[model samples]
Target: MPYASLSEYNFFEGELKNLQPVYKVIPYDINSSLFTDYAIKKRFIWMPKDVQANYTTDREVPVFPIGTVLIKNFYYDNTIPNNTTYIIETRLMIKKADGWAFANYVWNDEQTEALLSTQRETIRMSWNQNGTAITTNYKTPSTIDCATCHTINNVYTPIGVKPQNLNKMYTYNDGTKNQLSKWIEEDYLDTKPTTINSTVDWADASQSLELRVRSYLDINCAHCHSTGTSCDYTPMELSFSQSTVPENLGICREPIDFVTGDQQYIVSGQDIQGSLMHFRMNTNIQSEMMPPVGRTIVHQEGVELIEEWINSVETTCP
Candidate 1:
């Protein structure tokens, strides 16, 4: 049955505005996450009692049982005079016998309730970040938009629930522990490998530039760029496992569809200016930006990270 209001599901305890997860609903975070115009995201997974998700390969999504719900809420903080927080939307992906179903709930201005909505909507808001006032027209994705990215080979699937992304340590309400281990303890996952090939946190400068860049693209672009997806016709395969190969990252590969400026290769080694990937990441233009729909503004830090990685590459594309 479709829910008219978000509170109908009883996913959160106490006030709905608090956004706390209920006992069976476990909170989790990915190592490298998709950027959505700087909106902070909170993710949770809930499964039926005694049902556990089966672990697939590190790179593949976990096989979740039916009655599993992936919940994500998007919000912003430090808005207005008193550092008020405003939640924009909450997206849910529920696993059913047929397939995964997408639901989007838009929060009301009062911050009390969120109602199920299918139509596309935009909220104009401003927030303080690092003492700077930033404003944006935050876009709440329509159901069609959700389907566009979540669909893979005609099947709707969850993207970030893979072992590689969820293998990191999380500070839970009770205590800090590895997410996979916590899941195992909670009986949310059947079992995980002793040594999981985990993805690096893209924002961590201590990690290698290449790993950070690969992690960034893996979360942000790999969904569409992988085989059987929207941008699969393109040479690049941005998934972390495949991005280790230069060819899969489009190194020296010519852009087939379009070019920005004098861009020669999808990724020109040591030449950030000539790299199509860099240009696309740096732009906000709908036609030029990579993963264009989810973000309205350029992710400055992400672009800088890509630029540094490109400059570090020793191989110069001919």
Candidate 2:
């Protein structure tokens, strides 16, 4: 069943129930098509080598034509230029439904290079129009959006993916525990290893969770947490740097987590979990998860770091 029984005894669907989404992304393996998901996985990514070819990664679901208004976020996934990862959270059933609907919504796919193509056309026209137009002024979607999204998130997420738990402290695959590195060294993965400093213009801000976390919260959490929006079940009403620790203050927010020891998915807060973070990450999908737009997965390592950072909240603003 989509949503059997929440702590509230029933799920609550949000106003996002009317939209549907399709995805295209860069992939990891050069041998498959990224957009090959004709069967429609609940949550999955496009193959790096070919969007037309269908390839499935571990824990990736195969479902498409997600008929609902989902919160879609995009990324480049330089790790495998072929397919980028889009963190699409779904708010459709967060307010109106009675039980589990989906883990919000998220996945990986490509964008037909249309943005890149459009930029090229714009540049060509500029050249013909002025021949002396600032050649550097012409920008690509990857640049305009990538720099903003990545930098907006503290530039930690290259293509919207920060090497969460990266052991080397600066590199994703360099960590002794990073098994993914060995694959890259062996050329088994299309993604190349990335060093912490490898990111462009990262660390411009102080190396505090405030800066890093604030940036991420802005891009990831602020959409619904903002005023006038009915995102979370109880309406956490949070914004980046709004307080020294918005996410920390967000602890025990309802429809996200309820330490009252009573399950009420319909009302705010459910289960006796610590907060939405604990609940969202602890459980799998189709249940108490977040982004309330995309899938449930929580970006594994990314959440782990944010959780670690959140647990050690400081009064200083980020």
* Whole-model Cα lDDT of every candidate shown, in order: 0.89, 0.30
Query: Residue by residue across 12-95, what tens digits does model 2's lDDT show?
Result: 223222122223211121111111101111211222222121112221111111221112222222122223232222112211
Model 1 stretches astray by more than 4 angstroms: none
Q: After superposition, how far is residue 143 of candidate 1 from its true place, in Å?
A: 1.3
Cα distance off (Å), candidate 1, residue 32: 1.0
Best by TM-score: 1
lDDT of 2: 0.30
lDDT, residue 131, model 2 = 26
lDDT of 1 at 127: 90
Stretches of model 2 off by over 4 angstroms after superposition: 1-206, 232-235, 245-248, 252-273, 314-318
At residue 279, give the lDDT of candidate 2.
51
In TM-score terms, candidate 2 sits at 0.32
Error of 1 at 302 (Å): 0.4
lDDT of 1 by residue, 65-98 (tens): 9999999999989987668999999999999999
Q: Estimate each model's TM-score.
A: 0.97, 0.32
